[model samples]
Target: MNPNDLVQFLKKDPKDFTKDDIIRFCEENKIEMVNFRYVAADGRLKTLNFVLSSKEYLDTILSDGERVDGSSLFPFIEAGSSDLYVIPRYSTAFMDPFAEVPTLDILCSFYDNTGKPLASSPEYILRQAAIAFKRETGMDYKCLGELEYYVISDVDEIYPGVDQKGYHESAPYCKFAEMRTQALLMVARAGGKIKYGHSEVGCFTKDGKYYEQHEIEFLPCDPILAVEQLIIAKWVLRMLGSQYGVEVSFAPKITVGKAGSGMHFHMLAEKNGRNVMVKDGKLSDTAKKMIAGILDIGDAITAFGNPIPTSYLRLVPHQEAPTYICWGDRNRSVVVRVPLGWTGSTDMAIEANFGLKRRVEKASKQTFEYRVADGAADVYETVASLIIGAMHGLSMPNALEMADKLYASGNIFDKEYASFLKKLRQLPTSCSESADVLLKNRKLFEKDGIFPPGVIDAQAKKLKAFKDAGLSDKLLGNEKEFAKLVQKYIHIG
Candidate 1:
């Protein structure tokens, strides 16, 4: 049994977890409830609980998962043929931190009536896309999500924080530090490879409602697990909010003029388990191909990356978000940004200590960040689309040329590069436009039959129903209506 782990399991890694091991651990730890959790069509976690009355009952529950109404969970499924099975993955086992009773929670994958992996399931789609990418390019597409959100609460004005000046702000001046720290610990304990957590730059008070933004970033891993980590982190954050008598929102925007939450994804290419995004202190060719692929398909993916009406509002100019489709090194105003990756830098420890020697060679930390995604994104579908886009770029003959032509120096929005910014493409400004682009470019995602046509049609139909062509303009100068709109979507994750 590991003392550091919340679950007293003998296995150090959850990948090595087995059914027998889970049974033994539950019996020994007096776990009363076993919860099977999975992501439904609406991009929220659903759970089916079981009570462990006896060993035989426990074995049966673990061996053969229970049936669920697929029609209720997924909009595409017909009620007549909605029966589906959910089988738990041993690697996702964790103890429910919010449960009053001892409970073991394991994330499940969906299966159809024929016991085949559900083709429309987001999990299955992402898995197939990854396998196809690896088979085609002999390299892996690793990604990490930068999940940002605001913790809304009703508090007194004793300790107030300034608006848009809360970057890395500490306690007394900044609130919700305890909530963020607990979320970070729970995420790490639940198999999320967390990088760090901190206060963000969008803190303010409006009508007795306080909004403080915070972000929890994860280390790079396989795309499938990366999305799972984000989903789990969101679940934990919401659970904590409920317990703390506050509100947690992953909404893209809470008001008209402030920083909005963006779920940016940093991606890197790896071949033979070695980073290939940088070599000789310069961007590698493989990395450029990935950037080109994202640029080519950025607009179309907005259907999954920015699904809500308010998502377009967040992409407006002067908010530090991207409006044009372009790529640049460490530029925040472009859709695709190559962040500072510690390239050509010496060891910091050696520089700080006079007598210390360099012990190991520097590893590449270069990543291509897709800045178009927001909190309303369908995590699984969005990542699957990005992976397919990368594969497309790798296969394209003129991918490198495309990347070179779209590169901008410094901020693309700067007056110096105004001419170049105009030449670049523009991202969709409304959900209607995104739906149109997605339908037009459907062939890009359907090339290898990874994304089902039905799925694409459903998303397009949903986005078109919003009818928010000029929602931002209409809401301008109407603070009452804007506040109502923000409250309506203040809990979207």
Candidate 2:
């Protein structure tokens, strides 16, 4: 059990949090403030603070929730009828590690005046998508995000590190290792099922600023919870960065030639609580359908996964980012990748030590990673699109054929496959192009009214406002211009 988790410490199941329990805990723990946090349309965490005055006030706030102007939070909402309610989700309650006033933070959901979940809310959309996916496919779609960001600090020449060689470095070389480890612990304590945290393959010194890339990956879970965990993880990392007098950026690109951060998501489908992504030492048909489904609407997903202008710059060739829509085993150049896992090996304890007698069998860790998304992505919307696209592919009559045709045996950009790569469809090259593709393929997400029409239009309009068509080519070979663009969006994630 996590010692920092209030729920676990109280010996209560995570799903069993109640208002009375929170009130009692606050009273016993002498908590002074209650923070109601939720995700706004800008994809940032918004907070509503309340100083606990009396038991009656605490009960009322926790039970009935509070109201806020929806128009101000969402661009699609009208001010004339903008009153919306923010109700707390009990399971998301946690102690604010950074709060000095003994505060408790709880994530909230949006509800309309009629007491219905707001259709345009990202949290609601993601929950509905998960429900719909399970109902239609008889399987639960589990997803985990690989969040990558660059931590920037003032350059110190004493222990200066080499450029592009920061992967898994140790103390005295990795400047921010201890701070990142602290963030990992904080996130895990706050209910994020984190897998691990590590330094990545991008380190640079430019203009007396030191930039080092790092990643925090999580374990697979339900789509809604998965996205929530990621959002919280981002918040914790940023909060720690601020306390440490450094800057953390989730932007897709920091330079024109260096390695860029990609928020890659690994996906798996489970049935009866067992992974169904692999079968008989090979990729299963179910997995193929999901891949085919995502590939079918691959361009449309960019509207949510890669929304900003600099996003296209990172999608360029030779950056370990995908330029073409394809899937391959362990291929980083493709949009979808079936990563290597311990699928056929087990009993390592006995093999490593003859003194050991027990043979252990490992659970399946099979999954396919979607490498198209970046840090600028709205976690909820991006996940919802993937689920909707997967459902569409599962229902498609020719999904397997589509997957078969797009499968690549090796690096897609190789000379032998140069002719074949030309025939493969390319992802959107600019923010405007992404908006156009999303508009063209809007029907896929709108089939079950899962994605609100207004939300789609709003996102498209937002992307089009960037007016960044051919922006990558225009900034190519111009390091000064690229640096300006990177600086503008350095803290955008």
Candidate 3:
């Protein structure tokens, strides 16, 4: 389909499109709806197919709402109070390319039986945070992410021999380039505006004989689009891998000793169409304060950012993982990096030259890159925490004072920097500690009742179980064979 035609179709009001129009669009596009399962119930997703046959039925369901038993969802509602509604946002509907019957994918917001938004709904939490930030800072926050993952063949799980190539190694060594190309096309078809896709630098091999396996990274324009692309890309990769008898894993650290996957988020703040982080070609005070705020709240946010127990296996010191809490310009060792050549003018910037004059025009268009998150996290919650934290920093009484205090103190994880970090009252190292932090800071997320007490308690219980099992010690032992062992298990599993 032509981009212009797609745009026109999207512009049409939902009421204007008939059931036939949707069906015809799917037929023309050769879309196939494959597997669909309810997130909150056991019913097959095929039920939606019948409902879509009648516009009236669809509208009634859309208006009256789609009900589901939320008890089955991870860490949400309990079985006793499981009734939840799925209110699909019309704007989020997109054709699922892999669907055999030309299916559509829509993001759902969970609500109680009474029609009130559920506090545990990750989407609701994110929206609440966004609204709060706008109210406080008068800025519109935009986030983009570079998501990286690997594609390999003849693998049940990720293993040492699965991928045997260096970064950007193509052709014989990176045989999965074709798969990535197809996946990129699927992402495009799903309405995700991709900035670019390419092979990244992290690759390794178990068997010395075959060195063609590789990983690919995609950069998406906005946070929402990035997350949608992440989900769609996963589906496409799985389907493509099955065709070739291969597999793909988005595990933060799929294989031990190799470079782990990270969902690196880049954030920018704007107001009234002007970038708030840039002033006179340099990082504005607001930008620095936002970075400082991230540094301040990173530990607590890690519960959502690095959600899984295996995630810590990748955050070891000096492995390009963010074990320390610090931010620096062009410093990969730190948690946040003010990407190189971010000068206010695109011409003067490292990537491109968009000439714009402002106070920070000579300074740089400051963007903060958070390297902490992994694939398993709920993107909505993680992004919400960042927005709220940044806003908190911006509105702090002594923003500059806090920024300088953090910068001068250096890595928060370091022994010397521990004192300063203590002064700031940061989060702890283990999952249990993180849970405690979350419990102590529940007020932060409860401002609008966006995060339910039950949800938090449930997650804390899971974290506690892992902690009690000493799983972290077993999985992260010594950090030397950690990567290799993980790869072996994941590959074999």
Candidate 4:
């Protein structure tokens, strides 16, 4: 579809459009219905054949929704109350570019029979967190995530290459540029507003002899929109790759030794249309406290940021990934860095400052960037935790003291910082440990019933079982394994 077609489609009242409209559109466009499926929170999918000619069938499936055995899903409904429904949100509709017959896609949300939001639903947690933050702190947080993922040549096997070609190495070195361009197009077609896409120098490898490179790029969108983009991007990449016989992994670490992918979240708190993170051309006290809150709750939050066992592989020391709980100006070694703004010059005006700079920079203006999260995480959960913690900090004046202590403590692994780390409470190490921490700290996340007791227990049991079954062992070892072991019990997401 061209820009005009998209504009015409957008002009139509989506609510009035029936199944017939969709079928007619698909038929007119030579789109295939089989290319689409209803994805549920439980990770199960139901196929929708194109043969259905009735508009009511589409209405029932899209609006009336469908029931699923929630007990089978991850940490949602238990066996005793296993009934749940998935309602497709029309706003999320898009065309699958890789389908043999172009297929329409829609993202679904899980709801209880009573129409209440499911406690374990990431979307629910996110909305609750956002609402609570606004109500408590009088601050409106806006986030744009810079998602960095790799596009590998094959998916069936793990191929590790050490290439050091910094950002935008171009052509032969960046073999996946064409694929990324196609992916970006799909993202645009899906209504995701992207700032830019280019090679991430952070994940490059160059041995002076062998030149193999991996491409990394950023896609910018509002917090909710970004999560939606991620979901659709994953699907698009998978579908596109299948067509090209190539595969990609958003896994934090695809191989044993390599730069891990990170979903660096750029967040700013706004009030009455002004960025709250800035004050007098510098980072605001509230922003500092927010940063502190993240560090204070860093360990626990890691559970959501780095949810998978393999995620630990990318968070080790000296790997450009954060291993310590500290923040500094433009220092990637720390968990959070307030990048330096253009100093002593108007050309380097702070207006250009965005992303991490918006939250942490004060003199030059800054923003807070939660650096620990990875692609495997439920984006909603990760963002929710950060928003909640930041809001809590904003409400409490003492949070500044906490932030100072965290900043002064330096690296958590260092002996000198151990005292501060101990006082702040350690983060969970293993997935099971993280789940246990969540169970123990349920009150922190349970506000407004965002995390119910039953849901928490279910997650804990699942994580424990996963650990016992050796999933962590198979995915992580060495520095990553040891780090997880140490922080296995810290409560996070």
lDDT of 4 by residue, 272-365 (tens): 7667676766667978988887776677776567665656656766667786677766667667766554433454335576432445433433
Provide the global lDDT of candidate 4 against the true structure: 0.62
Per-residue C-alpha lDDT of model 2 across residues 1-493, encoded as one tens digit per residue: 6645676657786578887788888899999999999998777889999999998999999999999999999999999999999999888888999998899999999999999999889999899899999999999999999999999999988788789999988778889999889988888877788899999999999888999999989999888779988888889889999899999999999986889999999999999998999898778999999999999999999999999999999998887899999999999999999998667665666689986886544568999999999999988999999999889889999999999999998998889989879889999999999999999999888778799899899999999999999998898789999889988987785
Evaluated against the true structure, the overall lDDT of model 2 is 0.90
Worst 10 residues of 2 by lDDT: 1-10
Tens digit per residue, CA lDDT, model 1, 69-92 = 999998889998999999988778
Q: Please give each candidate's TM-score.
A: 0.97, 0.97, 0.80, 0.78
lDDT score of residue 245 within candidate 4: 69
Instruction: Tell me how far the alpha carbon of residue 321 in candidate 1 is from the true structure, in angstroms, after superposition.
Output: 0.9
C-alpha lDDT (0 to 100) for residue 404 of candidate 2: 96
Mark the regions of model 2 whose C-alpha exceeds 4 Å error after superposition.
354-361
* Model 3 lDDT per residue over 8-101, tens place: 5655544354444544554555544412222221111222333254445544654555777677664455698888777665544566665556
Local distance difference test values of all predictions, in order:
0.89, 0.90, 0.61, 0.62
Between candidates 1 and 3, which one is better according to TM-score?
1
lDDT-best of 1 and 3: 1
Instruction: Arrange candidates, best TM-score first.
Output: 2, 1, 3, 4
